[model samples]
Target: MNAPAASSHLLPAVAPRPVPQVLLDALSARFGPKQYSVAQAVREQHGRDESSFDVPPPVAVVFAESTEDVADAVRLAAAHAVPVIPFGSGSSLEGHLLAVQGGISLDVSRMNRLLRLDADDLTVTVQPGLTRKQLNEQIKDSGLFFPIDPGADASLGGMVATRASGTNAVRYGTMRENVLALEVVTASGETLRTGTRARKSSAGYDLTRLIVGSEGTLAVVTEVTLRLYPLPEAVSAAVCSFPSIEAAVRTTIQTIQMGVPIARCELIDVNTVRMVNRHSNLTLPESPMLLMEFHGSPTGVAEQAGTVQEIAADHGGKGFEWATTPEERTRLWTARHNAYFAAVQSRPGCRAVATDTCVPISRLADCLLDSVQEADASGIPYFLVGHVGDGNFHFGYLIDPNSAEERATAEALSDALVARALALEGTCTGEHGIGLHKMGFLVDEAGAGGVEMMRTLKRALDPLNILNPGKIFVL
Candidate 1:
């Protein structure tokens, strides 16, 4: 069964909600003139992300420098009952950071400061503006690293907001496991801290978990303390091809089930492979392939990878080649990380709808097979790539934004995939949070009661419903 779209949808404001002259004066007094931008040029720039959804620009844009700045911005917006959308890197695919309500877009990109690094504790404190790449570069020489690699160079705040996990999730786990604590500013302009930097916790309430995936719906993340891992001693990577996707997926299931402790096991369908090939200037065969990576002592990693190769052989996987050189491994991952862009560029003048689902390892084979069948039969354009180690895969569908028929067809395919995922005891969304794109499908996946509970929490934390209004649950 499918859930209906929003009832009586109200269009979002194109400009910031009309503010009184007196309030504007107050804002100018609180911060310098350059700190706030009410002009159309600024509002329009911060309003939209890479979402396929309509770009309803924010009413105003604020360059917040500190936690106090965020608090003041949220307070002022709430006073006028205006939405305060937190803007990060603007690379969100799910309409996560879009300013649909047209209020103040509080951009923290300027707060790119690395505060502290406790090598002993294996944790780092950073501002919301710090991107993962920047953070790692700052701490690389220290021999410690943050491992939640979301492919996109998304901001730590944005990643935490969306609960993002990427290629390394199968090895190091998702943002849920990496974020040790968060400093957030509530909708009421009050600041509070959630979680501690402790390695383990049996806390009364896991507020960290609540805010991590809340997608800026409850509070604005100002700072974060994240768990880190020591640099791996040894690493090995390879790109191996298979005659078919089923063979690749089956081999992945076996490798994981046999407990090879693989670090990365990503499945790239042949169509995606073709895209990557053209984009990267490689001449790989147009066959499904699995990108494998292992990290450990040299002997241990080599032995484990060989065992996985044997498992692949059993499933008829071939073309396994070692990317043993650091340069080769980096090049391989760089291509893989650019898969989404490559898929989009494969068809110019189109937007990509990246819909993904997760299934139990037991049913992963059948679930992936079903997805392949649906894509082939629907006449819709989609290519598959995923962290098969965790039974999570992303289906990229490049659709023309202008055609109603195309949009409808693509949407129908998304619904079908979501249904299939739920049927296989998986989730409608694996890593991406429920933003504007997936709200319509939430009822089918999480049920009305589950959604209501989500709304209840949103209302409890943000009674005014100003922080990212109309994001997750039906408001």
Candidate 2:
């Protein structure tokens, strides 16, 4: 399995990056008559996402409306040696949606629909296209909620595919813990469903997990069955201010060390505070803060809240603003969710370059210090935030996209961060899956034997190399 050669059709001319007619024909054959149009608008719309890079636009974009459509599209792609790129809400930050290899961009947006909500069982089945916000909207009156909130109202399928985690992951866990089943269309146009509704399974080979984080490389997720929860009896949040980054990190480490069960524990540096204040349109004082949340029976939440307050006090922390009202809690998370954009927005016209690294809980303090040091040494204007409870942090570098040197400097810092995480015996990626952006570093992190096994699985599943070609490996 070798990487596909760069398409010669991508000549730098007036009609640059010509779409392959063979792929267009395949789409028409698989999709039946006049439903799919070969219009330029479709191709332009599916070109790229929020990533800080550029690439060729997909040759065509098929609006997949059902699992059958996804399977057919994959078959068409396989037959023509065309790469298949699955797309959801186009919210990916890592170029996961970019058509690096020219092919049909399978847009799953049209498939958005809620199929089931078994409240008594505390589970839900949904089409991959339904956004998180959309799902909650449909189930708001049902007294059940999906807790894997990845900030953006990103598609549930997209979130699961990326193995995303956000503000609530500290208490609720990532998509890895919330997702129960998946209906997938494999590389060869074969459709299969994995995972049962059972609370837990010791079943053979954990296929559900394999597809959950595959990033559409192994399969296109058309449907997802998720583990839901009874709406918590009570939810409350407070923001605690710290004088220094070390103080903030120390508070976080100690809180987790004490096992406080805080549902959302995050570290926002003073630098990010300025950005949040401006971008959130609020006048929060410029300082390092630990934003937190608790979920349980009212009395239990209260006890957990008191435990956290005591722990933070020992670490020189202050600024306790309890967001007890629903509106207050919404406002708090809204600020946190927009942290990425806030960092980018601070520097007008600049792009946010983010790198994710997760270290062992015991090594979090050292990892934080090293990240700040390396980032400072590189002299990139950056903001730091994290799911500190899980020792996963993100360093977002703001760069002027037009300046090549500045971009290179940011990329160098990013590479250093991944190396540092690997050196600390942690993963280069914790939540965000190893999409194309992390593939090269994943090899370094995964080592030779690990990558070889990955290649073996790639060959076993996608022998033609038609599904997301050149991803996760050079081979």
Over 1-475, each residue of candidate 2 has an lDDT whose tens digit, in order, gives 1112211111122222334687687678767544466677777677777767667687777888889998988887787667888889988877778777677788888889999988988999999999998898899899998888776779888898789988788788889988888889999899888998888999899999887777777788888998887788999999988878788888888888888888888888888888888887877768888889999999999999998888788878887889988999878766578888888878889987777888998888888887788777777789998888889988889999899878877777777777778778898887766666676667677778898998888789888766766555545
Tens digit per residue, CA lDDT, model 1, 1-475: 2323531112333444565666566666787777887888777778767667876677667899999999998888788788888988888877776766556688999988999899999999999999999999999999888888777899999999989998888889999999999999999999999999998889799999999999999899999999999888898998888988888988888888888889898989988889988988988778899988998899999898999988888888887878888898988776578788888898888887777788898889888887788778767677789989998888877889898777676776677777778878888788877787777567777888888999889879888888988677646
Instruction: Estimate TM-scores for all models.
Output: 0.94, 0.93
Off by over 4 Å in 1: 1-25, 39-41
Best by lDDT: 1
Q: Which ten residues in a row are the worst by lDDT in model 2?
A: 1-10
RMSD of 1: 2.5
Scored by CA lDDT, what does every candidate get? Answer: 0.83, 0.80
TM-score of 2: 0.93
Off by over 4 Å in 2: 1-22, 29-41
